[model samples]
Target: MNHALKERIIAQSKQLGIDKIGFTDASSFEHLKDSLEEQKAAGHTTGFEHPVIEERLYPEKIFDQPQSIISIALAYPTKIKEKPDIVRGERRGSFARASWGVDYHNVLRDRMNKLMAFIKEIAEDEAALTFKPMVDTGELIDVAVAQRAGLGFIGKNGLLITEEFGSYVYLGEIITNIPFEPDTPIENQCGTCTKCIDACPTGALLGDGRMNAQLCLSYQTQTRGMMPEAFRPKIRTVIYGCDICQQVCPFNKGKDAHFHAEMEPDPEVVTPLLKPLLTISNKEFKHKFGYLAGSWRGKKPIQRNAIIALGNARQKSALPDLLKVIEEDPRPDIRATAVWSVGEIVGSKGNPELEAFFNTLLTTTEAPEIIDEINKVIKKLH
Candidate 1:
């Protein structure tokens, strides 16, 4: 009788603009627990994930008498509609597809709320029932639940790949006391393909879905501190997040779903001019980018990455802006990055005016960090 409720949910989810939905028994994730432990021991977690191992593996800890978990996947767009040109002298940085749309957290939560309300309405006359909905930031391992529910298989690149939607989906789930028939786990589809692994600039993707989060460019981009020296060039033009692995995935090929209007990208915000980000006020930054998922770490990381991107571009046109940031930016890290960009843009330049200014700051700067950064860039310039 409770199994019939699953049919109603499928209908409700479709009505709510949810791309895909599946159900799994609310049992402990035994296999995932072991893998998570291994990841923790090896320091592979991205720190953005839930820190508690037990809570992440056990559904019962979240909801009393939990009997089922409903895993939902919402497909997002891959290709932009009428993307703006990124011409020379006006180079812009890229935000990963995941950050292109309005924050998926809100979109997924709204859909989950509607589904929860519908479930409550239908189960009102039955035994006491409860549910807990969780998105990307939630404690439960979303991909594991989705895989168990047969929504998709976990690919080597550490993303869930559904047959219909490929790997371009935002996942969320509702753990409930109401029992639902469990779905079969999807068969592993990645056969002898190493594109995502070979294509990863940092080699973050270990074989068979394991990953080293510390070396991941996507993970590094969200960090506020200066990026690792070796990875700066690898960071390329991504100011916020990276999509290299996903871009190379075969399953993600020809998979662009414009399912919801809310998921559409404002190309201007997603691919903003790198130089402008160096000076955007906090209020303006929030107003322009706060709606996107990439802005969660605030402007520091974005600004830092923008500096790295400018260096990678080696844009002589950006040299003035980079020098201005080095001279005036309050953040030491930002200024340090600007120093790096300046060196990349104009190596060993004989420009008299800039040379005089550089020598003046090197002799006059009080902060040791800034002085050291200026000297390091000076070495690179020579």
Candidate 2:
């Protein structure tokens, strides 16, 4: 490994807007793979993670003969500069910090491409500098690559926490055949602080950087269909993702980076009106929110979560909107959630519209799940 070449690469990375650059050998992530397997056996892994754990553990599976991995992180803004106004009839839902700005996949990919281009220029006619760029959706576990590259330590909340940016950073990696000197990993700093754990509405943050993604509200919110009944109240107004743990971390207390302009959040999109989302058209949903990472699951999951948000808030004003969804929304999941919302919002209030819908629904709807939800809500309300 050439020291001057590493310096040149580091200098080039800074010029390309990469907030942090660290290098490590593309060796097997043995411990991480073992932990992942244990989690999978315990049925704790979110299905959204890479299905093949083998590829995640070994970077060679992605690019054969890999010698080094270049890990990069770009810091995103943690604070909302311009929050939108919510009128009397409106309740707004929140998107997570990661989903605040533009989709990070494209943004990180572009940066990795520039780094690769620079490496190729310097390696011209000499170094065997083939590379593979991986973002969030890529097979390699980004946090593992980042940790190996000395970018940051894995926080208890299952996020990479850099000294410079806390956990408010988007990570990506370029695995290359050319060997670069590896940096020493950053030491873990979450000593005895249970703030993130205590702050978690759901007990997802298991000790030693482990998490039960099943109980994680962040995963729960993203999932389509009915979320587990127990988690409904815990979610509150979070329509897309949860940030409770990150919000409470002492390291993240005041670190709000505005490095990348594209990573800046448009407050309106991040905190949208709950009612409009209940019936947002697909075309319109895409038009306004397609660029965001939170919109990845499409309208159904977000809308389903929105209905629950309304119910959790118990907004009497949202009653009519909830009723409309119960009557007209195509998805049984949405209608089912609305059924619960209608009851939860006006619990035993003696409203004719609600009582009548409940009376009629019990008799007409044959779906056991919907009827069960109706019965449960009715019982709770009474």
Candidate 3:
């Protein structure tokens, strides 16, 4: 491919909502297959088979006769005001800022498709060179490719960080048969900065860039099924994703760090009052949060998160909602969370209603797991 055409593609990518774009020779990622195997051994990459990812690691699989990989970074604005008090209980609902707007995966997919169309138009005469665009969906290790393509360096938080946008950008890539000149990779800038590691409530980030996914709060909250007992209190108020490490990064300092247009939380769900969130009907949950990223886990996890948040907040006002979920929720895990939240709410106050609920649970001849939890809570209360 001509250098001029490559430059034009980069410029067009910026116009298509990508903040940064860089190209790399398709052959540069030869070592990715080995690295992925190492990650698998370390338990960093789960639910992904090596063979599937190996195919994508070799760029030819994405684009036969491929010569270049165009990596693009879309900066998710992080311009919200800090409400430390809200972390305590002064706020209503809470969600990570990145998830406040429309689903980023969807946003990036739409833009990538447009860029591919432009590429096809410009390269129509070149034996119809093929192209494949991918967001976070593919088997590709997007951050590693972006780093090799010189978009940004990986920070201590295990996030790709750009000097201008800190680590608030999402990455996507397009592999094409058209070869383009590659850019030099940027230097690692995280010197002596331990903020992300220090701020992690669950110690997910070790000194090395490697992260323990099992201990990660973000992964914990989004995961379906039962959460481990030890990490429950550490979850804080997060319903979807965790941003404690990002929030404390020195690179993200100052009011200017906030991206005004995209950082603000949705008013309906922003710092949602825990009392109301626990009682949200399934219909209301779908209508309010369906478009947001957090809704992917469905009403159960969010509801379970709400209960946990209420427990952490010690909000007595959330008792009724907790009671309702405890009695009526179809999911056993959700009922279990409600039981825990009610216990927290009634913590020395010991509401008669809650005591009565526990009494009824004790009489029940079914769901031994729930009965055991109820008994545990009652024991704790006494």
Per-candidate TM equals 0.96, 0.96, 0.89
Tens digits of lDDT, candidate 3, 237-301:
77778888878988877413333244355655655666667667889988988778778778877
Higher-lDDT candidate of 1 and 3: 1
lDDT of 2 by residue, 305-365 (tens): 9999999888889887888887776677788888887777877755665566777978977
Q: After superposition, how far is residue 154 of candidate 2 from its true place, in Å?
A: 1.5
Q: What are the per-model numbers of colliding residue pairs?
A: 0, 0, 10
Q: What TM-score does prediction 2 earn?
A: 0.96
Cα lDDT, model 1, residue 111:
93
**What are the clashing pairs of model 2?**
none
Model 3: colliding residue pairs:
78-258, 78-259, 79-258, 79-259, 92-271, 92-272, 92-273, 93-271, 93-272, 93-273
- Candidate 3's C-alpha runs over 4 A off are 28-35, 42-51, 81-91, 124-127, 255-264, 348-353
Candidate 1, superposed: residue stretches over 4 Å from native? 85-88, 348-355
